[model samples]
Target chain A: MAVEPVKIKRGFQETESLKMLKESAVNVNLCYQCRKCSSGCPVADLTARDSVSDRTSAGPLDEKTGAGPDSVPEALRSGMARDSVPNSVPEALRSGMDLTPIQIIRAVRLGLEDLALNSKTIWLCTGCETCATRCPQDIDIAKVNSILRIMAYKRGIKPKLPNVAAFDRQFMANMKFFGRVYEMGLVNQLKLATRNFMQDMDLAGPMIFKGKIGFFPNFSGFLTMKKFLSRFKKARAGKN
Target chain B: MPEAIAYYPGCSLHSTAKEYDESLRAVFTKLGVELKEPEGWICCGASSAHSVDELLAAALPAQNLQLIEDMGAKEVAIPCAACFLRFKTSVYDMKQSKHLEGKVAETIGKKYGDTVTIRHPVEILEKMFANGAKNQIKKDLGKIKLACYYGCMLTRPPKVTQFDDCEDPQTMDRLLKQLGAETLVWSYKTDCCGASLALSEPDVVVKLSRDILADARACGAEAIVTACQLCQANLDTRQGQIAKKFNENFNLPILYFSQLVGLALGLEPGKLGFDKHLVDPKPLLRKYGLLL
Candidate 1:
């Protein structure tokens, strides 16, 4: 039996959020659930419960994938060779993060805003552009994830991954103040924001020993950065 | 023969990836390409600004692009892949949408004509080597096999970068082959290195980097070469963690392609910052007789 496509809500195009996404040029409707993006995405199935062998060897290939290569979905069969697709997602890495790249796009198209916004997939995205590059529809899924991240922030919906959210916030603050990234300050700020002082503390010894981490911040372009960032503040205030 | 091209090392070159800065300068100088850095170049708002405020991300790189224009250069070479992607995306976005360009100009207080072209060091080197620069190689790299890992940002999202083939980039491989190093055919060339999550969620990086390193080892590579600083750092600094977490022995030295180019050009290993690596590459270089 053929699975039916999910119906999009009426007046989706008239919504402000959809209009913003449309302006960004990401046409979610063009996606036909090809699964190419999920296949190539590094973080898509990191938290998958199935072991690599269980997923690659037994279940997906047999039960889900049907009999043989001919039984496979046409979209996947056309994109990747059968042998090359195995073991793409490794064994259990961490917990949570269920949605894949293809799933996230589907959620957005179906007007499931909260599901897409609060997904751990959006936070865990490395902005690697793998999904964007391989999409048959040419939808910039990575760009959509970035936009969703910003939207999540605007809505004050807590990020699924707090540490990743903290890191982005601190990184922006670092750029705003120093004009350039101050690794030392940024790390300290991230540590403070996340309150996970012990994490990655071991690497500090080697990093300092090799002079990889600069101890001080550079403020050479501080005034210029402050002046430049002020314009955004003014614009935001004007809009509000 | 060409006039000086603008060099934007980004923030990492000045700090965590200082060796990349040193070796890139050394190799480019050897290739007779003059690099002029724009004055007071700010951050391109790398993964952060874009993830938070789209306008801020576009504005940050616009300011730096304006500085490059002021330097009388039409092209800029960005070594860090993260910074390169941000700059290129900003330019691509502005060129595609005039509304974005107007908003960015308003935010930055300056209008950028989107005139500057962004090129990765690999692209620049590939062009140079093809154009009679191969004669500059002072020493052959012998038969040491390496995996040329492009990580994610280098040639991806072809619409923005418009560089080599995104699926299987061979520019770095072909460039290294010119100096006599064996480049392995690996499937993880454009795979993600978990760079954005390195600081936030290292367990993910460990798992991701482990697979990348394991694939390289499985393919009979003695070392890994790359053009991204974050990939180099994640692979180099996390090998022990990856080993401890996964019980796998992958001690491969992740090297910048520029460092190898400097070595092949007869520059001293110490001068190329080989000594600064967490996983020392000296023994591998010595075994291949590329270093004394």
Candidate 2:
């Protein structure tokens, strides 16, 4: 199969959001498509491209020579030890977000800020740091996703995964109001806002019985909390 | 006795994970380490704040660190993995970015010089009992099989949390071993439990946590021992729902490492807050003859 020549678009400038992500210390430009970050990602099961066939068929010798092998090496033909390679991208990835960590980084590097910011992968990311930890380039992909989320929120970009975004907003609001997470407040607000009332209702009775649910917010730290929040707002305002 | 270390339980200890707080205190006291919680400590801003506002996330935890400095404590111990990550990230940010330090100081209405060292209870217990806590062990848990789950925050993004190897951390495993519990080597030790999404996206939590539980079960672990309150809550509370959703029977009892440590230290099960867990660990404890 002959590969087609890809045309490179010229005179493209980096988006402000992309520059902001770079300034936040996420070296998106350093990702060399090694896909190590994607390979080892925990959620790669839900996010990475299904490149398993490509991986299994393209043996080490074929990959090194970039040619079809007539007589493949015995070691290479059998495919290197499976244990040495991370699990192949699972079938689950085909259903959810198509963009992997490397793909997200690639989008940012290519100045596709809108595509990166609006990606379902950004919202689904649990911030587990698996991508960041496994990134051979040491780029903090998790931090980049976080920054992209903030930018997406600031720009009023509607998240494809609204529940995830709603949860983040409700959680932050709870923190801002109580200077800590008020579980009841957060839950009630989230349920009302997202209309996800019956999702975890079964566990609530047991949780209450176990004394895990507090009836009211702890107002003891109100004063120091006020100071802390005010300063945080001032800093954010200054940044804006 | 060693000098008292400042303890910041974060919001979860005061609310949902009260058992974790009690068990941690009981275990530490038995180990002869005094814990002093600073007055009026707030939340660590958790996953929510960081996702929305980075500055708030830094400031919320910095305020607590400031309180530790105010108490003149040389070190502060955080039991919750998420809180530990927040504090560590705050200290890391303050050291790396003077701009962040100034903003944090401005927000907290106080200047913290980053003198107080942040320590996770696991790290402290690992160091304190490095020579084996056998002497402190009253009820041997040698018969109990446990899978130590580190979840996400305890050790992730090695630069932010520079405690152990990010991929396969062994701090919790080593701690469980000290308690004489048979710790199982599992693949999902550091996997995420869907965290805050536990509320917003229960299905996601169910899917992800179900995998962790199934993996532990596959390794022949009788119970899943977790260091994070969120991990414990998610894994314990969602098992039933997961069982129904996936048509699989998963009755795995998720426990805090502190609860197991308290048991080894001869603390009463009630005192350790065993009753608070959704998936009662008492049955598992009794099965292993660690409980009467």
Candidate 3:
């Protein structure tokens, strides 16, 4: 689970990517490496573990959040009330993040464009907003990740997590065509794009039997969405 | 009668999470609440638009918000937490930046102010229960130990969602308790179930989902209840794979909160779309004698 030390490419402050990131309302400079965001991030721990194939139950349970049962309201622990401290991650889950949430923020602040764009942490983020909610600086860390993802996409950085990017691309393609997500089409396209056709074939039968997968696409707003997407694309074509 | 509210099912409810669409409508009908679907509604662009282009993400939901306004309804009940978050995010972004608002207006070909209020089913139903919706319940959900999983979208980024407590939302739990079900206090309430990763990264889904389902089981929960379609689909449909991968038995049925409310209201289980769930809730419901 150890991560190699990231090489700092010197003299790259305020690169184009960093300048673009600054355009976002989020003040990346406010991040003081508080680690508060990483402390509560759910997927940060997953980055520390090996790829999915070698994963086991013991891998994720290693680094539980420091703010354990004590941070939870007394009422909630006893089942008398139903809320936990808004900022605390699960006490039993541990963190072994390769590039934790703090690191990503730091990378952005330092204009380490490559490091921030190419890290597994950005793709791993579930946009849970746990980091954003917990940050003392009021920085929307998830929004930072979102902007970084688009930047990564625009640069066509070979995704650290290709399937994740492929899925999002296929999903957007479906939205552009149908004005709605065609679940059947999206899945098939994703399978074809990722060449992962055999991955979830087992679940397909049961899903179809249960009527969970819709074979036909819904074209309710096809024309309007098509027009809207073209206009939006045309308006933003040269920018960013 | 309470004022009829607008309904935005999003795409998942029409396909993957159709049971949510069915049960929500059934429960609201039993409670004498009217639900209206906005005409020509499109997808909210879920994670895709937001991840790739901030403008399109806001614009997609902005168009739907305009439709909801055109219907003259002040509020819309979004069943999918993902859609609700997108709608809320668009409103939040537009209010925060006039430039983004102008861009979104240009993109969607519609200018919209923050005219529509977005409501989650949990919020909608809780308000009804407070106003005597409980009187309609014909049967109590006898001793069915449940964990109300409110995954990420429903209540996080408190600035945008302005929903229940971000870390530990209790609205769904309290509503179920009123229906006579035992709701457990678990720490993974607002945790991510690796949403939408089920298709892209099954390993992440299995790992994260295993943690969630295992936590519920350790807490003695016989089933898990959720208000989000992705949470339900991930936790319910991925149980067998999770069990095999983790060498654990977590055959927990992930039921939509509306399905449970429908059961409490004495609606037929068939009408609630229970059969559509991959992880069948029939045996569990039958064991509680709620299903005959």
Poorly placed runs, candidate 3 (over 4 Å): A1-12, A47-97, A237-240
- C-alpha lDDT of residue A172 in model 3: 87
Q: Tens digit of lDDT per residue, candidate 2, span A1-240?
A: 111333445766678767776546566778888888777665544322112222212223456765542243432532243223323223333344557778788777777777778777888788888788887788888888888898889899999789889888888777767876778888899889998778789988999988888888988777777877666667777763
* Greater-TM-score candidate between 1 and 2: 1
TM-score of chain B of each: 0.97, 0.96, 0.97
lDDT of each prediction vs. the true structure? 0.81, 0.77, 0.80
Cα RMSD, each candidate: 5.7, 7.2, 6.9
DockQ ranking from best to worst? 1, 3, 2
Weakest lDDT window of 10 consecutive positions for candidate 3 chain B: B242-251
| Candidate 1 lDDT, A1-240, residue by residue in tens | 112355566765444445668888888889999888887787775533122212122223356546643344532442233233333333433432567888888788778777788778899888888999999889999898999998999899999889999999999889888988898898889888988999888899988898888787777667768878788777555541
lDDT of 3 by residue, A1-240 (tens): 354566666775777656655555678888778898986777777532222212222323224554333333321342221232111223322342457888888877776778878888788788889899999999989888888899889898998888889989999888888888889999889989999879878788999999888889989978768777787876577353
Give the better candidate number (1 or 2) by lDDT.
Answer: 1
lDDT of 3 by residue, B1-292 (tens): 6658899999988888888999999888877778999878898889778889888888889988888899999999998999999999988888877778888878877789677888898998888897888888899999799999999998889888988888788899889999999999886778888888788777777777877876777678999999999998888888778666666666788899999999999998888998988878899999999999
Q: Where does the lowest 10-residue lDDT sum fall in candidate 2 chain B?
A: B242-251
